[model samples]
Target chain A: MHIPDGFINVPTVVVTSAVSAGAIAYGVSRANRRLGEKHVPLMGVMAAFIFAAQMLNFPVAGGTSGHVLGAALAAILLGPWVGVLIMACVFIVQCLIFQDGGLTALGANILNMGIIACFVGYYLYQGVVSFWGERRRSQLVAAFLGAWLSIVAAAAATAIELAVSGTSPLAVALPAMAGVHVLIGIGEGLVTAAVISLVMTTRADLLQLERV
Target chain B: MRYSFLDQFSDLDSFIHRLDPRTKLVSCLAFILAIVLTPPGRWQVFLGYFSLLLILIIISKVPVFYVLKRSLVILPFVVLVSLFIPFFKEGEVAGSYNLWLWQVSVTYTGLAILGNVVTKAWLCVLGLILLSATTGITDLLKGLEGLGIPRVIVLILSFMYRYIFVVVDEAMWMRQAWHSRSFGNKGLRQIKTLGNIIGSLFVRSYERGERVYVAMLARGFDGKVRTLHSLTFRKADFYCGGLWFILLVVTGVFLW
Candidate 1:
């Protein structure tokens, strides 16, 4: 869901860019608290790992393939602050280095894929896992639902932005974006659950931050 | 990950490559803003935008075909998002189709808007591709930092660029191992193995993070990250940036 330039109007870009910058600033301070002297390398490495993992495509349904969005996975593995940082880094690299997204739309992309996905996914997972009791099974279910909902939420936000910009009317853009993302979310859910379950089974120690 | 995939042509010597990355970055942002602000159905303006980009592509020495092919990658996504607008938007009916128990009408106005959105998106992508194709990621990150983006964000981006390929190589090795062990099974079983692969990759990455930290410490890395500033704005940057700005303003004014 990398929204290209011209997908949203100039006013929308300005507003979202301001909001995104504020959110990122808050996330940075929060992340700084957790990132001590020793944690710097881990933070950097984790960001790189997320970037690398995104390049790995998995078979979804039919012959189609989907890559991990890694927002929920990052939040579950690291704290939400670090999760936001990682996603933001990935987005910046994609925009500047790869041209996968537009520079003018960077803040919007960060807000949608980084902030929205990371925060929403993290909180929803906490809520679900708490309700279900923190077992392996509960964590897996929570991961699946959290990942799926995060995609839906980001997609919906993108739709709203498009509508607000008058790029497309709400009636037309909302359902269209929401519909496509619902399917994408299924893949997101499955990958999220599978990775979490596998980690829980194999190297549970690596999920030390999940408790935080 | 193909590490060079993003900036494969960045090292090539050209006027565009030689300019300060900050200038290129700002000009790119300006170009996109101009494209977005242009009113719909101004076909002349769109042509002007495209022609301007074509000239830049020539000056940059990036192959026209490479840019064209790269720009097309955004079309499927553009189409997917905008295709239904023609059906749902109400206007003078261009065509009507009866399906099952309902009728759907396409509007001329909607089609025109759709075309405008696609064209605008394509032009914006071209600008982005040009910016990325000529500038290295490290320089771009430095440019971003110089432009007053927070240091923390810049540091994170630099780390991402430096180590992304190493992690990708690890992933490729794991996938190779998986393929060697398993074959002809494209079903549920493969997904489970895929999960195992991802889990293992994460574990390895986490451990490597610790090792990398140790190595940094050994090399006298403090908690604070620092980089030597190597970028300087030359007179050529001003000349090129001024010329581009004037072109954008001239094209923009011709519209009214």
Candidate 2:
């Protein structure tokens, strides 16, 4: 879902870059103010973990495999702001070092994957957990739905950007992007739920760590 | 154990390799931005950009095969996203096909746009490959830091770089263990097992982070990260960067 450079127009790039930059700057200041010294290493390590975890692909269907985008998982594990930071870092590294995404499209990628995914997944999870009571089952259910929707939401956002850039029309891009991601989102949901359950069983304290 | 995959050719000596990372980073961004902002169907401008990248690839001395292979990674995605454009776009019909109960037509404008998108994406990818293949990851991060990227981000990137391989190795081991224990299990069962592995990895990484933080505190690490070698832009940076920028501007003006 990483958008390449030419797929987006200049206005879209500039606007998205401005928004992402502002959000990241806010996140950095929040990290500094709220968590102080500990969050630096913690966020760093979590970013690395997310990056590496993405490499661990699981079999989906038809002999194909998919990996966790880790935005929802990160947001569930860390708070949304820190999740945003972690994901932005991951996107930047992927773009610069791995060339997995485009340089000019970095802002759009970050806005979709970093901010929108994390925020949507996180708030949805929080809302579900709060509404359903934070039992293990509810948390797992929340994780699943939150993760599933996050991917779809990011995909939709990507499609909208593509349409707005005139790369693809909304009539085509919307349904196509969202339709494919719906399945991918299921895999993301399952992995997210399983991972949450595992963490709940093994190291629940990590989940309880102070959120910044 | 082999972590060279990240920056395999960065150690090679060449003018591109030796140029300040900041210069390379800025040049790369400029190159891609120029490529992306250029109006579509400017075949000459696109060719000029490609030639510029080709010249850099040659100068960098990284294997041509490696650069080509790396740049091709974007093709499947580009194709997947834009493949239907030719059919969906409204213009002069290039061809029409009757499939089952429906008729589909491809448009000349749509095909042209699709081709233009692919070309732009490919040129941008080539520019990125040149930047990444020549500069060490460390130097790139340092350059980003030098360019006024936040200290927090730079630190996070550095720590991530240091430990990604370690985490990846652990993940591989866990996958190996799972493969040994499971016997052709597919579906939810497989996803559950993978989830457990991810959770365990997360826990281990979190603890490692704590340990690292404690170690840093013990070694007098404040909230600030300090590096000994700072990046400096020498005479070569200005000359090369200026020439490249001028070339890009000239191409944009004359070609446009």
Candidate 3:
């Protein structure tokens, strides 16, 4: 869901950039107050981990594979605010270093993959876990659903941005982007659930870390 | 192990590479904005932007083929998203075809938009390639910090660049180990194994982060990051940056 330049117009870029910048600023301040000196190396390493994890692809079907977006997993492990910062860092590095995303479209890409994905996944996972009383099975199921919905939501947001930009009509971009992501989201969900389960078994204390 | 792949051509000496990274960074953004903000269907403007990037690439001493190959990274995505625009757009139909139970038609407007999008995206990508290829990653991060991006963000970026390869190597070794141990099992079991790999990676990275923090503290580290060298803007930066800005304005105004 990395929207390259020209896929959206100038106004869309301006609006999304403003929104993402505000969210990131708020996240940064919150993290500064809450985390102090420890957050720097930790967040940086987390961002690197997410970036490296994205490169590790798992086979999805016949001759096709998908990789984890890592937003939900990040949020599930860390808090939403730190998740935002980590994802934004990953997106920035990807855009500047690798050109995996366009410079002009950086705002929209961060808005979709960083902010939207993290918040949606985090809130959904929290809601599910809270409602289900945080049993191991419930937490795993919540993680799966949260990861799945996060991808779909991010894809939907991209489609909406494209439609508003006059690049494609909503009727077409909406279903197409969301439909493809639904399958990809399944892979994301499975990986997230398994990873959480692994964490739960090994370092359960990590899961109990205070969400910033 | 090949860590320099991210900015492979940045070490080469040239006018483009020698200019302040801030200069190259601003110029690249200006070029991309010009390409993206141009009105659709303006082939002349698009061609002008393409040639501008080509000249820069030539000056930077980066291989044209390398830039072209890197630019193609966006092609599959562009094609995937815009492939249906030609069918869904409402305009004077250029051609009509019958496929099973449905009649599909391609419109000239749709084709034109598709071409414009692909062209614009290509130009912007080439501009980015020019910036990244000419500027080393460390220099680029320093440039970003010089440009008044937040200090913590810059620090995070530097750390990410420093350790991304380390984590990547670890992940690759784990993948090799997995392949060696497991049969070609497919389905939930495979996903579970992959998850274990990722989970283990996260744990290792997190612990390494703690170790690094402790190491930094041992060296009398504060929250502030200090670098040995600082960037200085030269006369060439002003001349080149001014020239690039003027060219962008002239092209945007005259062509529009």
Candidate 4:
């Protein structure tokens, strides 16, 4: 979730911003190595795709709709570094251009949505796929688990940040944030799994090339 | 199809719109920092911050109703996130509730904090809306670059701004195709169709990326992106920054 400004205190903001800056710097260098002159523009396109995909709402059960968060999807489709970079880019644009997120809390948003979601979701997907043997079914299962867990994890991290900021005690914030997100995670899992399955069926080669 | 851009009013001529984007960008950040850093329950300070943003909204001539409406998007989320704070935060119990196995008590201090958080977030969003509504995304990115953000990130954002609508249109076409083909699909079938749309969208995007790269290469593209430095700080920018600084200092003094 996008943490608006004032939700977390000033010290939390400073610390998270520093961490986000480091992670983004590392992500950019890593992406540079992965992407050559011929592939430089691909990152921007992928970021755009993620942003557009996020705007598309699909029907979940009970007539409710949810859109793609695209972190797990990005990491699985691209490498983790590229995934993180794309996510960071998207968040920055959302904050500065769209005002969808707060400028002061941009670091917290990136940390939660970009770094944590991409890395944890990517590694978890890889672990599940490897352990279960990569197949169409395994791809679906891994995508589902990765997306689901990543969202819950980000929510948990946000709760901790809030607690640390003394906005709310961890005991209260953790369960509340986690409970809502656990349901949100299911939506995330379904969308991520469906897309990954379709991609696996069509452009299996792309996934193979990007697989870490 | 025509899509309305996010910064539709950015091209409008106004004092706020004409100011250097870098100045606006930094000032906006400063405004937000000032809002967030204010101690909770500082009602006067919050009001001061709100008035400052309201003045900017008026000067920007971006239509106060539009900014207010857009800023309301954050309210649901803020309420959802902080709704339980009063109940869970342990302090002087303002009220107590008994619901089966749980006893929930809300504290006045917690309620005050929650109110403070919501007000601060709303004000911060208003400030940001003022910034973005006045400055184009391209100029915003340029301002960020001039402020020392890395080049790679800026390039990525510039392209994202340019092509986000393109991808959206592509996704919209796919949705139209799906809606037109499947009359009454629901449940798993609907998700599957949506998945197909997203999957195909990704492939299309990937191919487009390749095509764009090749097109760039055809023009003797290099890794480094260069842009014209057309942004110049005016006396107004300095005055604007100074005015904000003075207002913020006054608020800080009031806090003290």
Instruction: Please write out the lDDT profile of model 2 over residues A1-212, one tens digit for every residue.
Output: 98887889999999999999999999999988998888888888888899989988877668877899999999999889999999999999899988888988999999999999999999999999999998999999999999999999999999999889887878888998899999899999999999999999988887887665
Residue B230 lDDT in candidate 4 = 95
Score every model by TM-score. 0.95, 0.98, 0.98, 0.96
lDDT (10s digit) by residue, model 2, range B1-256: 6878888798899999999999999999899889888888899999887887888899889998998888887876787676567556578999988988868788888788888888888888888888888899999998998999988889988888988888888988998899999989888999999999999999999999899999999999888766797788999899999999999999888877
Which candidate would rank higher by lDDT, 2 or 4? 2
Q: What TM-score would candidate 3 get against the native?
A: 0.98
* Model 2 bad stretches (over 4 Å): none
What tens-digit string does per-residue lDDT give for candidate 3 at B1-256?
7968788888899999999989988888888888888889888877777777788889888999999999887876797687567556578999988989878888988888788888888888888888888899999998998888898898888888888989999999998898888788789999999999999999999999989999999999888887787798999899999998998888778776
Per-residue alpha-carbon lDDT of model 4 for B49-89, expressed as tens digits?
78878887898789999998888868666777666676555
Docking class of 2: high
Q: Between candidates 2 and 3, which one is better according to DockQ?
A: 2
- Report the TM-score of the second chain of model 2 against its true counterpart: 0.95
> Model 1, B1-256: lDDT tens per residue?
6657768889889989999989998999899999988988898988987899999999999998998888876766686666666555567998988978868788887788778888888898899889989998888888998889988778767766677778888988887888888877675677677767777788888888889888889999887887789999999999999999999989888954
| Candidate numbers, best lDDT first, in rank order | 2, 3, 4, 1
Ranking by DockQ: 2, 3, 4, 1
Candidate 2 global TM-score: 0.98
Chain A TM-score vs. truth, each candidate: 0.94, 0.98, 0.98, 0.95
Task: Give each prediction's DockQ, rounded to 2 decimals.
Answer: 0.66, 0.80, 0.79, 0.72
User: Of 1 and 3, which scores higher on lDDT?
Assistant: 3
TM-score comparison, 1 vs 4, better candidate: 4
Off by over 4 Å in 3: B86-89
